[model samples]
Target: MIDTNQFLAQMQEVLEIEDRTLSPDEKFRELPEWSSLAYLSTIAMIDDEYNVIISAADFRELQTLGDIVRAISERQP
Candidate 1:
């Protein structure tokens, strides 16, 4: 089972977010840290941590951090 909190922490690390804690409901794209680089980093992070590869197109469709967690959870074996 993928834990949401752990996932959030990983996101914070991957996104280089340190000023504030990440919430599942937060719209990640709206964050100042969010960028093209952040998107790529997130893809790599998910692949490395969860062994799940999320394409840029699919990743772009995700609105919130919770959506990302759910996507990864659903794809995991």
Candidate 2:
């Protein structure tokens, strides 16, 4: 099972907002650092870490951080 805390920590690192606290229901795009760069960085992080290849369209469709976690979890064993 994927650890939510570790996921959040990786997300914070990827988004370059390690100081902020992240919640599962938080809207990822609402973050101040969320941008094209952040989006691509997230995609890369998810792929490299989770071995899940999420497309740009799919990434754009994600709303909450929980949604992203579920997506990755679904892709893995």
TM-scores for every predicted model: 0.91, 0.89
RMSD for each of the candidates: 1.1, 1.3
Worst 10 residues of 2 by lDDT: 53-62
Clashes of each: 0, 0
Top of the candidates by TM-score: 1
TM-score of 2: 0.89
lDDT at 17 for candidate 2? Answer: 82
Instruction: Report lDDT (CA) for all predictions.
Output: 0.89, 0.86
lDDT for each residue of candidate 2 in 13-75, tens digit (9 for 90 to 100): 988786669999989988888988888888899889989997767767889999899888878
Q: In model 2, where do residues sit more than 4 Å from their true spots?
A: none
